[model samples]
Target chain A: MIETDWLWGLLGGLMIGGAAALYLLVNGRVMGASGIIGGLVDGSARDQWAERLAFLAGLVGVPALAVLLIGGAETHLSGNPAVLILGGLLVGLGTRMANGCTSGHGVCGISRLSLRGIVATVFYILVGGIVMVLARHVLGWI
Target chain B: MARSLFSALAGAIFGLGLLVSGMTDTTRVQGWLDVFGDWDPTLAFVMGGALIPMAIAWRVAARRRVAVLGNPLPLTHERVVDAKLVIGSSLFGAGWGLAGLCPGPALASLGWGGWGGLLFLLAMLVGMVAAPAAKARIDRITQAA
Candidate 1:
């Protein structure tokens, strides 16, 4: 299962990279989903709303429609509503504050070797790891 | 016209990649974070796979001043490494660990994740909307300090 996981991960990652590359090559925009969506909502991206909307239509619409076709997208979300809300707030606020997220900073930023991207990724992962340890083990909250 | 079509196509491919890579699965993501426990290194492979093509693409992009659709390339990046970047990323990371859902997985899994995904997404949007105010307050505090 682990070995196959790697294979799928690699293939899927390639697809993601390809998608980012295509967005860059064709659209000339960094393929950061959070940035794309955030821009639209924050009033900062109003000028490019059409393109952003189109991108999201595919980002959201595809998966939405795909489950109907392929039928599998199992997610193990937490049952606790509080945790979900807190987590959502943190993700939204933090990604916006930092100007990126996993896709923007992790994939696109690191690929370009941007210092901000690298630093953001490292901090987030480290903090995330620490939080995971505390929440899952020490506190047993998650 | 053409740009919108391409953007949608890119989004579709990206969503497909997330689904294929098992990133949409919270267990897989949590497993990767559980380094001390039963760690799953699959996420690393996904990152590796994603980096290669993206790295190559960046190189290709470096040569062109504009995109195929003739829009100016958006390649310039923030060079500063400040409190906002560190604190924001750290917060985001903590939140991600708390709930195995980041923007990509959270949005991508909406169809199947149901109410949970919907609620999370909604809350996240609220956070996004509220971020500017928070940042302004933080900036004022920092400046005073």
Candidate 2:
């Protein structure tokens, strides 16, 4: 199963990268998911609201259409409200503060070899792994 | 007009990729991060696969002064590895490990993630709204230290 999973991952990754490539080559912008949505949340994208909204509409709408067409998708998100809320808050605030996330720093940034992108990726992955170990192994909460 | 259209197209493709690649699955994401336990290496392929086209895109972008649509390229010039970067990334990582959802998947998963996903999205928005002030405070404290 893991063997076949890699194929799907790779194919999907190519699509993702292709999208980012198109966004850059045509839209002249890095397709950082957090930055795109963050601009809307913070109202900094007021000047280009249409563009940002369009992007988000697609980001949200496509998945929705897929769910309807192919049946529902499962997230397997934790049921704990505490975990959900805390994680959500941190992801939002932290992405905003750092100006990137997995798509931004991990994919776009690293591909370009941006030092900030590389550093941010390292910190997040390292810290994320540590937290997972502590939460799952030590606390048994997650 | 073209910009918005292209943006939407790109975003749609990205969302599709997330769904198809299983990045929208919390268990898969958590499994990837769970290196100490039963680890999943599927995400590495995703990351590596994503890098290939993007790297080429960067090279193509370098040769062109303007985007295909004639917009000035919005290339980032940020190079500083400041405290905000470190602290913010650490926090984001913690949240990712806890929930197994980052910004993109969190949004993409909303259609099927049900109430839990909605809750996470709402909380994420609130946190995003409050982030600037938090950063300001962190800056002050760091400066003082």
Q: Residue B76 in model 2: shift from native, Å?
A: 4.6
**DockQ each:** 0.85, 0.87
Candidate that scores best on DockQ: 2
Candidate 1 lDDT at A46 equals 83
Every candidate's lDDT: 0.89, 0.91
In model 1, the runs with Cα more than 4 Å from the true position are none
Model 2, residue B18: distance off in Å is: 0.7
Residue pairs in steric clash, candidate 2?
none
Candidate 1 lDDT over residue span B1-145, tens digit each: 8989999899999998998999988888888898887998988999999999999999998899799999888768789887788889998998899888889878878888978888889988988998888888878988999
Q: CA lDDT of B30 in candidate 1?
A: 82
List model 2 lDDT by residue over A20-124, tens digit each: 999999989998999999999999778878888898889899988998899747899889999999999999999999999999999999999999999999999
Q: Count steric clashes of candidate 2.
A: 0
In candidate 1, position A40 carries an lDDT of 84
RMSD of 2: 1.2
